[model samples]
Target: MKIKEIQDEIVEEFSHFEDWKEKYEYLIELGNSIELIDKQNKIDSNLIKGCQSKLWLYAELQNDKIIYTADSEAIITKGIAAILLRVFSNQTAKDILNSDIKYIEAIGLKEHLSPTRANGLVSMIRQIKYYALALNTN
Candidate 1:
């Protein structure tokens, strides 16, 4: 699906929950459902900086689409990354770079997160974009 379409779907999904606790449980579920990254790919180079928890992101270009795989020591972080990968993965580099992920704000996730996790989220997004930028040119 297109990025906006996927994001809108997420917004709809989050709207079903009335409270943060339920939302958090949903996040855990998303994290658990994330496609597992290879153990070898979880290396120091893939680790995203600025996150309070250890988070690793690996990306590769496959058939002109970027595939993202991530893991985090913290469940919430992993879940957040899963959300991001769900939106950005299997997409063209330009599409990933140009897409605006407004669902984060629309779902009120950023405000509810701890400041550190919020920063981690930003870092994760930035790193994903950086990967797209680097790979898009090739």
Candidate 2:
């Protein structure tokens, strides 16, 4: 599915939850669904810059698409990163570049975050996009 479709689905899914706590719980459940990145790929250089918590993202080009794996030290941030990876990973470079991530707010995430976390989200998005660009270049 497209990124917007994925965001819409997330919004639809979380809208049923009454509060941030429930929403956070759902996000954690979602995060748990993703496979862990192997130790070999969890290098420090792939870590996201500007995040208050340590966040690592690794991407590889496979069959002309980018496949991403990410992890974070914080649960909430890890959930956010997992959401992003689900939407962007396994997509073509052009698809990743063209995706509109603003729907994150529509899902009631970024606005609820602290200023630092909000900035970290933006930085994470930029880093993910940069990985897509790098894959395209290669």
Candidate 3:
């Protein structure tokens, strides 16, 4: 699906939950459902900086699309990365770079998160963009 479409779906999903607790449970579920990153790829180089928890992001280009795989020591952080990957994975580099993930605000994710996790979310986004930028010219 297109990034906007996927994001809208996420917003819709979040709307069903009336409270933060349910949102958090969904985040944990998302995190658990994420495909595991290769153990080898979970190296220092893949670790995103600025996150209080260890978050590793790995990406590669295949058939002109970028594939993202990530794992975080923190469940919420992992879920946050999963949300981003849901929008970005298997997408073209340009699409990933140009897409605006408004679902963050739509779902009030940042406000609901601890300040540290919020910063981690931002770092995760930066890492995804950096990967797209580096791979776009290839």
Candidate 4:
């Protein structure tokens, strides 16, 4: 699916929950389903710096698409990473770079997160976009 389509699907999924508590539970479930990254890839180079918890993210270009693999020390952070990967992974660098990820606000995620987690989310997005920019230029 296109990035927008995947994001829309996520929005629809989140809309089913009646409250933030339910939404957080769903995020945990999403995090639990994230495919584990290889141990070798979970090194310092991949770690996202601004996050309170350790979040390791890696991206590689395969067949003109950016493939992402990630893991996190925190469950909520992991879930956030998984959601981002679901939308950005296996997509062209151009697509990833152009994506605004508006679904984050649409799903009411930013308002629900603690300030630190929100910063982490912003850092994660910047890192993902950086990866896309680097890959697109190479």
Q: Candidate 4, 21: how far from true, in Å? A: 1.5
The alpha-carbon deviation from the true structure for residue 106 of candidate 2, after best TM-score superposition, in angstroms, is 0.6
The candidate maximizing TM-score is 1
Q: For model 4, how does the per-residue alpha-carbon lDDT over 2-112 read when each residue is reduced to its tens digit?
A: 999999999999999999899999899989998677899999988888887888899888999989888999999888888899999999999888889789888988653
Residue 120 local lDDT, model 3 = 75
Name the best candidate (by lDDT): 1
TM-score of every model?
A: 0.93, 0.89, 0.92, 0.92
**lDDT tens per residue, model 2, 4-123:** 788788778877988889988978876777646668988888887888788788888899988888787777777887788888888889889988877687778866345564436777
- CA displacement after TM-score superposition, residue 38 of candidate 1 (Å): 1.4
Tell me model 2's lDDT, rounded to 2 decimals.
0.78
Tens digits of per-residue lDDT for model 1 on 74-94?
A: 888888989999999999999
Q: Note the Cα lDDT for every prediction shown.
A: 0.88, 0.78, 0.86, 0.86
Clashing pairs in 4: none
Residue 18 in model 3: shift from native, Å?
Answer: 0.9
Clashes of each: 0, 0, 0, 0
Clashing pairs in 1: none
